[model samples]
Target: MPRFRLLPDEQLARSPLSQLWREFARQHSAVAGLILFTAFFALAILAPLITPHGPYWQNDALLLLPPSWSELGLVQYPLGTDDLGRDLFSRILVGARYTFGIAVITVIGALLMGLLLGTLAGMSRGVKSSVFNHILDLALTIPSLLLAIIIVAILGPGLLNTTWAIMLALLPQFVHGIRNAIAEQLSQDYVIAYRLDGANNWQIFSRIVIPNIWEKLTLMATMALSTAILDIAALGFLGLGAQAPSAEWGAIIADSLDLIYIAPAGVAIPGLLIFLAVLSVNLVGDGLRTAAKKRREN
Candidate 1:
């Protein structure tokens, strides 16, 4: 008797990103989040070309027209018109650029800064580590929003300053998290082996530690992104970020507060988008973490 042989086809080689994408795609919530996340960025990036009316264009006659779906709403303004007759749809579209764009900048800045400090702290002994730890503790104690508010206060309000403020506020969490991961990685047998082979700190870190902790960094970065968005929104709501006619979600909602009775959709739409955007990032981040944990186990 003869047994059938397994198929001869070779399994395709995959990179970590490809593997992570496959894993994230396998998760139902993650797939949905990815779709929404993609759509959100797409909308933001394409706002200028796609939006029917100028975000700042005003017409008193068209002011406060409810969503087309409403009884008296105009069909042309699907989401509705705001108090100033600017298209709520267009403004929200443009707002995505300010909201998500700033979030991206803040997350990236925080990531780089955190990774640098954490690496320094992790690699060093005594004073260097102690100083970083103390700073981390101090940062952790002060609330992130409060920290951002203080930074903005010092820098004065503007887009660049606001982005930096958000980044600074989020930096401590990254520093602490990355430092711990690096410290643990450095304690492993491979690292000790590399050291025995006369590897310098940079060599070991570049060759071993980074490869190992890369997944963890991605997870941390994704988590930080959600926090960044919330902070940016809070700043905009408090008049500390993108000023009038700029159309950030929180700013839009803040501006629309007076018209809550007549056009609550203005408030509700931006609020819903913020909720959806945060939820999407969180779900995707969770998926990445679940995938990472499973990988580590195997």
Candidate 2:
């Protein structure tokens, strides 16, 4: 009997989740983004264990304290203390949880709605396509920020409301992308063959169309994740997102703005984390797109 060894690439690509992971790891920026994202997530998840103080608790003695150096025998505050004497580091860790949670929820909601609407529109050509496409165009024509503000204002401010706002604002893009992909797929010979093989519309859609376009959908979802994070941060900055006492990054930045001169690190810390998170998401999205294109070409 011959000794057998599994090929690493072959094994990875054979598993559904591992295939994407392998693709992510092979790209330089994607790997870096994954590392940064994982670090932030870990910080968020392990906040209580790592943080010296609760994010909400404040101490007057520590108020507006600058970052301390061990050499100076003053090492209490690592990232410094905010105006209320709360640890900036702790707040940031908690804020990551809030921001990322909202983004993930919003993205998943938008993708679900868009996929359903887009698939429906694609399966039905004439009047259905026309109406759906017109609606999508109208939605796309509106400024996303303005739309989000309108929705949030109508729904009232809160985490749930903010998420709904982001989802509504994001749905149009997904609809548009999926509509285009599905329309193109419908024109392919495989679809015609499926139709001729006694396959009903639903069967053709479920078995053939969806699987073929899933890769594109995954790419869109990754890009949407970045956009969702940015949108939520913007909403928080404008006071329409995670409200006060929530330790959200946007709210943290908003509160720290007035105290920038007093403790610049307060604003800088949250802002830096938001920036890095969004950047990492975008890098990962770009890497996915590149890998997907290569896969298609091959």
Per-residue C-alpha lDDT of model 1 across residues 95-212, encoded as one tens digit per residue: 9998987798789888999999899988889986897699789889998889999999999987779999999999999999889999999999988988999999889989898998
Write one digit per residue (lDDT tens) for candidate 2, span 1-298.
9977665676645754455556657889888987887786676677768777788888898777787753322466678778888888788877877787678778889999999988887777788779878988998998777889899999998878989998999999998999889889889998898888888988877888888888888888878888888878888889998888888888888999998987777788778888898887788788877777655443
Error of 2 at 60 (Å): 2.1
Count of clashing residue pairs in every prediction? 0, 0
Clashes by residue pair, model 2 = none
How well does model 2 score by local distance difference test?
0.82
| Best prediction by lDDT | 1
In model 1, the runs with Cα more than 4 Å from the true position are 1-15
Instruction: Report, for every candidate in turn, its global Cα lDDT versus the true structure.
Output: 0.87, 0.82
Residue-level error in angstroms, candidate 2, position 84: 1.4
TM-score of every candidate relative to the true structure: 0.93, 0.89
